[model samples]
Target: MPEMTRIVLAARPEGAPGPESFRIEQAPMPEPGPGMVLLRTIWLSLDPYMRGRMDAAKSYAAPVEVGATMEGGGVAEVLASQAPGFAPGDVVVGPTGWASHAVVPAEALRRIDPAAAPLSTALGVLGMPGLTAWVGLDHIAGAKAGETIVVSAATGAVGSLASQLARRRGLRVIGVAGGAEKCAYAVETLGCDACLDHRAPGGAAALSEAIGAAAPDGVDIYFENVGGRTLEAVLPRMNLHGRIALCGMIAWFSGKGAAEPMTLPAVWRMILTRRLRVQGFLVFDHFDRLPAFLAEVAPLVRSGEIVWRESVAEGLEAAPGAFLRLLDGGNFGKQLVRVGHDPAGT
Candidate 1:
């Protein structure tokens, strides 16, 4: 029998995940049975939500059990098919885990048109990350044109799209990121009105000053991706009846900053005084919006009007290390693992 390489959860980490927490192994090559398709993974997406899945704590989704293949989204090519409406050589995007190949039900896969955009984009924009940005900004935040919007982790996959979407809608967008280079990408490439480097020496104080300068009238919508200090800084600048789309919180996900106590009383007071509406969004629950999101965002991406970036790590063995870097703010853009060679030359 042929073999396939996979990465599995070797153990749970006490704090931030290390290379020791994951194990690389070879398994029997998966074969399609009835109503199934054999997929060869080309690109795998590493997202912040996977951090929550690594822990044993309860969440909206089940955790990846110790010794099980780590769950993930991937772009793949169908090698064989036994189901209707799907055929061999079709490229697809779905939950294929951290493996070189996958045997998934045909119903789980969504075919991607290679001519429409880059195949790797199925794991970034035009896929889950794009869907997340759109749903949060449109549905949860109810963003309006001319409103001032703040996007944290603004150079990341979700944040990049979120900030761009707001800018396209005629909103004044200010982005908060870790370093000067990312801040530049947010402003120059992603078209944010202004971007602040939160990793500077003065940290949150510097961010406050930048936000004040960028959105002098006060922020009307906040797309929150990093919760810790960034959230604290944005609260004081919020306008009356401001709306916040509380997305991923990569700051405390690894337990690195878990010891720091957040002063919630001040936050609550601001919520009361500003009459803020903060809503936490889960992309899994909003899959129904994928069609609508892709319809609107795809043309813009294809025409180069909306730009996105990706940081790719080669091979399945790099998956664990790449994911750890993603959790630590080391990734420059959307973190993707090139598990296998894409036939489309992506």
Candidate 2:
């Protein structure tokens, strides 16, 4: 009998998850039912939002219950289909969680053409993260040419695309990343006007000064990802009537440093005084834009006009470690876990 391997959440951590939080086990392979397809996961996307799912806290999405398979999105190869328009060997992208195989409803899966791009990219640059950067920048932030924008986590999955897109729109982009190397990549590769190392010794004050120098006219837009110190640094620098696309707050995902209260009154005052338009968004709410996003970005990706990067963990068992590394600022780009062999060779 064939077996299915999965990683489950063993425990929720108080701060910064560890390997002990996950457990790996094998079970009988799942069978597809009516309107469903049995898929072999090819690429599992590891994102900062997964950290929030591990906790039992109330949020826009429900938490992954203890002992349940850790939730995630992935690209998979269809092994068997019980639905129309899908067949064996079809590659699709959907929520596959942390498992070697899954039985997903056909409605939840979108078939992808491997000939158009790498299979793994269906989980990264061409998938949810790509859609996120597009919707956040164009729809939410309403970015304009000649505007000064600051992108936090500028070298990571979403930020990388956001930075590049901003530059293409002729915006002056100042990127905030963790290290000198990532900062350099933001400017040189992502085409940011300037990049700041948020991990630099002096904390938020130093980062704020750098942002000031980068955008002497004040920040017209802020693509917020890491929200702790980076948010603190960019708030006071925002130009009057600036826009903020509130995305992930990875810095507080593990609950670390969250006990230290931010001065809400001060932040509220800045928002009111500057007339900032801050909008918190979930990419899931904007799937209607996927076709348009693909129409614009797919060509750029194929033409090599828009580039992306990934940090992949080779197997299912490596997911827990890789996820912890991601929270610790260890991943270089979009983090993914490759659990099954790709029929379309890389």
Q: What is the C-alpha RMSD of each candidate to the true structure, in Å?
A: 1.2, 1.0
26-122 per-residue lDDT for model 1 (tens digits):
9999778999999999999999888888899878989999999999999998999999978989999988999999999988999989888999888
Residue-level error in angstroms, candidate 2, position 306: 0.2
Q: Mind giving the per-residue lDDT tens digits that candidate 2 earns over 228-324?
A: 8889999989999999999888876776656324678988999999999999999999999999999999999999999999999999999999999
lDDT of each: 0.90, 0.93
Which regions of candidate 1 deviate over 4 angstroms?
Answer: none
User: Distance (Å) between predicted and true CA of 159, model 1?
Assistant: 0.8
lDDT of 2: 0.93
TM-score of each: 0.97, 0.98
